[model samples]
Target: MLERIGITNFKAFACQDVDLAAFTLLTGLNSSGKSTVLQSLALLRQSHEAGLLDEADESGGFLLNGELVRLGTGQDVRHESYTEEDPDITLAVVKDEIRYAWRARYGREDDLLGLLEAPSGPTSWATRDLPSLFGHGFQYLKADRIVPDVSYPRSHDAAVRRSFLGARGEHTVNFLRAHQDDTITAKSLQLPEMPSTSLREATDYWMQRLCPGVNIETVGIHGTDTVRLSYGFGSGVSASNRYRPTNVGFGLTYALPIVVACVAAQPGSLILLENPEAHLHPQGQTWLAYLAVAAVSAGAQIVLETHSDHVLNGLRLAVKDGRIPASATAVHFFRRNGQTAEVISPSMGPDGMLSDWPKGFFDEWENSLEQLLD
Candidate 1:
């Protein structure tokens, strides 16, 4: 698992280091640099996947626009307050007691920043020695996910060959259709209430938490390169006719990728989620947090970016109930301080109490209640 990430002269941060855990929660207001952290990691994965991180090749460097992220040129990613003395952009990550660092020379209009050869940098290490970010079992789901649609793209390379649900989760329907019956090896992620350990069963079990008695089915639209997702209510003879995705609520469709991601997580996997709580009700948001916690228990690392108090409280409840230990979780509250972004990490205790709650850290409810009481 990734223990820490260090950034220098990157977007929204002049220099900053953020500690990571098995399950990390990043909460902050709009544009306070929350997404920047995820983007930095995604950028690294994108670069390496495109054969740009080959330190031996001087032509290789960071790939700004790619499958995972679409960051602009160096001029767009470089911090505004970078010092002329050290203008190069650097990113480093520590995993399993090894530190991998990279420094890229800045170019105003260039999207592929060139790598600098340094004795201590990753340029000398082999591809196998690099961090696990470049390997399989990595999923990055952006905030803007799929909505209710008649059919979604069905790509054999993306859904079956790579087992990748697109960043926007556009390929989720096809992926589900291909692997619905595969057994979920992670015991912790399998709900006891469900009779089967298949991915389809587990997905339905979790989705039911958001909408009770809902069953899902995915099928390839004959003669077309697309997959259709339909939902039905009830069971056996009482079951309602299968309804197209367009007939269901938006929240159910929007939450499908997240549900599938957590259900299919394996040991040593890295899942980066952005606003899994979007379109979910308070209770459903809490249940989603529980699902993520279960994924962590199965040995996968989850880095969640959310703006829901229900999600936060669900994590606390999980810890309090012994579902997950306090030491395995980390919460960072972020906010802007002038031109740069700042982070405040609150420690979690065994009893699920937080060591500190910053001024704007999920206090809106209390602040409003006090005003109403007065």
Candidate 2:
């Protein structure tokens, strides 16, 4: 697994190292550099998948535009006040204590940033396996995901071969349609209430947390290369009429990929989520946290970037409730200083309380309540 990530001359950060665990929560104010961290991992995965992360050739390097992330050219990714006279951007990851760093020379208008330096050695499973980033399973869900669409694109390579749900979750319906019957053997991820432990059944069991009695169905269009998704509610005596996604609420569709991603997670999967609490209510947001915890407990590594205090609280509750140990989880609160970004990670105790609460770290609620009561 990727134990830590080190960034230099990246967007909003000159230099930073973040520790990753079974479940890592990246939380902070808007634009404080939470998304940047996820983008870094996505950027590496995108480049590696294309076989561009090669040390043999200096021409090989970070591919800014790809399936996982489109990070633009050097001007867009380099830190505004980048250090060193060379102005090369560097990103490194520590996997099982081995550090792999890739330095890319800056190019003004080039999306493919050439490598200045790459890891050199006899190749083995350490670099070959790359447990968290490759092989096992990977999913990157951007904040702006698919909405209530009539039909979604069906890509066999993306959904079936690669098992990717797309950055915006555009291929989610097809992925679900293909893998619906797959059984989930993870004890932690299984929903006891559901009769079967199949992916489709597990998806419904978890999706209900966001919206009660909600069920989903994805069907392929007869002649077209598209699939349609519909929702139904079992709320009342009147059995829910099967309705198009447009008829149901937006939150259900918006949160579907996240739920599906977690439900379909394998033991060594790496799931990077951006605000899984997009459109859910307070209770639903907390439930989403529990779902993330369940994914981690199932043996996957999840790096979540969220702004919801409820998500934070839910993680703390998970630790306190003995669902996940404090050590298995890591929380980093980020903040900006002028043009550079900095992170302050308050450790989680066994009791689920943080070792320290940095200013503006999920304390807005208490701050606002005090003023209102005063």
Off by over 4 Å in 2: 56-58, 122-127, 235-238
Between which residue pairs do clashes occur in model 2? none
TM-score between candidate 1 and the true structure = 0.96
lDDT string, candidate 1, 107-142, tens digits: 999999998842254542534554347777788999
Q: Give the TM-score of candidate 2.
A: 0.97
Error of 2 at 160 (Å): 1.0
lDDT of each: 0.90, 0.90
User: Can you write out model 2's per-residue Cα lDDT over 293-351, one digit (the tens) per residue?
Assistant: 99999888999999999999999999999999999999999999999989999999999
Question: Whole-model lDDT for model 1 versus the true structure?
Answer: 0.90
